[model samples]
Target chain A: MSDIPADLRYTKSHEWVRTEEDGSLTIGITAHAQELLGDLVFVETPEIGAVFAPGDDCTVVESVKAASDVYCPVSGEVTEINEALEDSPQIINEDAYGAGWLFKLQPSDAPEMDELMDADAYQAHVDEEDH
Target chain B: MGNKTPLYAAHVEFDGKMVDFGGWDMPLHYGSQVDEHHVVRQDAGMFDVSHMTVVDLRGAGAKAFLSNLLANDIARLKDAGKAMYSCMLQDDGGVIDDLIVYYMTDDWYRMVVNAATRVKDMAWINKQSAAFDVEVTERPELAMIAVQGPSARERAVPLLPEDLREPSSALKPFFAAENGEWFVGRTGYTGEDGFEVVMPEASAASFWKALFDAGVKPCGLGARDTLRLEAGMNLYGSDMDETISPLEAGLNWTVAWEPAERDFIGRKAIEAQKAEGKARKFVGLILQGRGVIRNHQAVNVGDETGEVTSGGFSPTLQASIAFARVPATIGDECTVDIRGKGVPAKVVRPPFVRNGKSCID
Candidate 1:
């Protein structure tokens, strides 16, 4: 089974959002998402200060197999991007939820968090995909 | 789910990520494909290649039959255990399949063909062999393992039966030797010093375990593809197929035109194409941008457009590379369509990396 932390919220497309104490939100792909992509070789993170609507393709992650787009789970402006991934994308494969976080976003509507799937729902979604 | 190879259970036991490939459940990678590719280049690695079909042709008319069946002349394999890489062609000069034929004896020749083309290849060979009095027998009970790298032989030889070790070690590239039930051939797709051992299916699992214990990392199809591409080897279905002729697929050298009296299956069409000089050029491309190139990408060359047959990130070269078919008038530079944008690329002679080193500047 893939790691699905109960504290994090997720989208059907596999992006995870962690609400920060300061009202900002941190976003990254789920461990299940990284597992399917295999080892990541390259990452093109969204630009800091860029605005994105919910479900927008905000980043790109490439593996040895193929390239994939990372969707934004909620409408927000990118406050900070993970610059470390520019040098070593494998960090995402190593720690998908921690240092591998893609970006920090200041949400336009904090209520959108309720729209995302909780840990149990996301696990069920991943299980459905496997079957 | 698909048909399983003899090593299916072994792959799962080794934590291989299994995927469906050409109707077979095969490992795509153990962990990291890039790591597996480097292991074959810098050290030793092994792959379960039992999904490939092995056909044995035995009869007095075997040699005569192959001469007509394959584009390359099997008569060139005069010495016993010598092998020849050839294309089985259709009458129109299009490739049926690219295969390696080994001459084991006066009346026995062995062939290994792509896994995906098994059904059609068997039917075609059977149809052609009816008139030659040759018996075409599919060897489904055989399992093949390719151990490759600079140190591959050094690591693999110790595991073989006592008497077979010496001969297997002394085997030259493109040559094979029989020891008991094992047919050990000194050939590999990774452009490294190695052996492709064909043995009985029942013993495959144990042999794989032994090789793993000997420090030979188990590789998967993912690495196999990258290694072969880096070595500039053409893939059967991707590089050439029923619609693509060997002449346009960088395999003209494999065709034998000597002994003018010899008429192979596709000789007439190939001869006509050679005379016309309208054949498209096949060349290698090195991407000058950050994105990965993929199959069927449009290649804009001069005024005409072409297609990329195979394309991926070369873990060896640390750059994106591809094989493309373009107009004969194409020059040193071209643009490949990555997504919607055109990415510039430099054209170069293939065998991009050979002997674990980059062949390009």
Candidate 2:
């Protein structure tokens, strides 16, 4: 039972999105996602200016045990990435939603946010997956 | 929810993330696998390895039976309490299981084998013993815990049974000493100075608690794997199996080819394979570019392709290292197919680290 901030929206694939004042969308793996992946050894972030459709594999999180893919939840162009994760992927294990944000996207579709699940719905989804 | 070890409750108490390993509910990590790995390298850490099979053999023909059963020569262990690592092979020259056997006396020997291979190994052992007078007994009532690292001996010595404490503290490598039902060995898979203690199952929880109180970190299979991979030790099902030979699994040195008249199982087949000069060789791969190496990845040397037998990230080296079985003609360089792209990697001799130091240049 990790913290699920009500203000953020999430995808069933476990990506959390926070809307910024500039209309850009910040994205990262959920805390539950990080917990399941164990301690990370490396993180491969999507490059800036790369275009992606919703549900595209945008990031690769390599833990000591296994590697996992983080899918992009919305159609957008990558605007920024958390470069600090390049050398210190442990940040994702420490603060999954804060300092561990993977990338930021300049949205190409406004309705994608509405299509995503709310925090409560995402929590239920995680619970269902766990069971 | 599966087969539970004596330390199952302890693992749950310590917040271990349990996973199903070969039908046994075991811990993958207590918290962070990397942290546990470093602890084992720099200080002392303990792992509950009780799931591995332990068996006791006793009879007049025990010595002769083992010499014929294992790939490695058992006659080499003449001294009492000497231990040897060996592979049990099928009649067709394929590995049945990799195990460690200890000679306690002329008529008695103890063997510890992999958990996943227990059923098949026991069947083979029992079936083979019908011709000999040996009695094969599985010791399921025992629990094994490995205390490993530079300071493992010092920390564990104080807690041993009083009469055996001094001798266990001074035990030499690849040797074992027994006190009643407790057996302590100076051998490990982590490439470190350590003690592997086997005691009654009823006492496992208390012993684990005592070690924990002495500042020994409780590690899980996750750290155990990374540590052993760095040490160049092979896992049973991954590195070799019933379909693979020791000659192709980087275990050629474990085979005792001398004493030509001593015929062991699979000797003729391996000798035949050796004479052909077409046997693949196992080596270590260090990733030169981005991304980590994983088991079953394709390794390309020129046009020849081999397979990664076991692979993972090395916390000690801060790089990805793997055991790959490649063609005999593989050069110093090869490309590993990671994901869908070809990634370059350097081939080195196995064992990327030993005794807390990096073995690679």
**Which CAPRI level is candidate 1?**
medium
- Top model number, DockQ: 2
lDDT of 2 by residue, B122-190 (tens): 999999988888999999999999999999999998998887798897788999999869999999999
lDDT tens per residue, model 1, B113-156? 99999999999999999999799999999999999998899999
Question: In TM-score terms, which candidate is top?
Answer: 2
Clash-forming residue pairs, model 1: none
lDDT score at residue A1, model 2, on the 0-100 scale: 71
The per-candidate count of clashes, in order, stands at: 0, 0
Question: What C-alpha lDDT, on a 0 to 100 scale, does residue A32 get in candidate 2?
Answer: 94
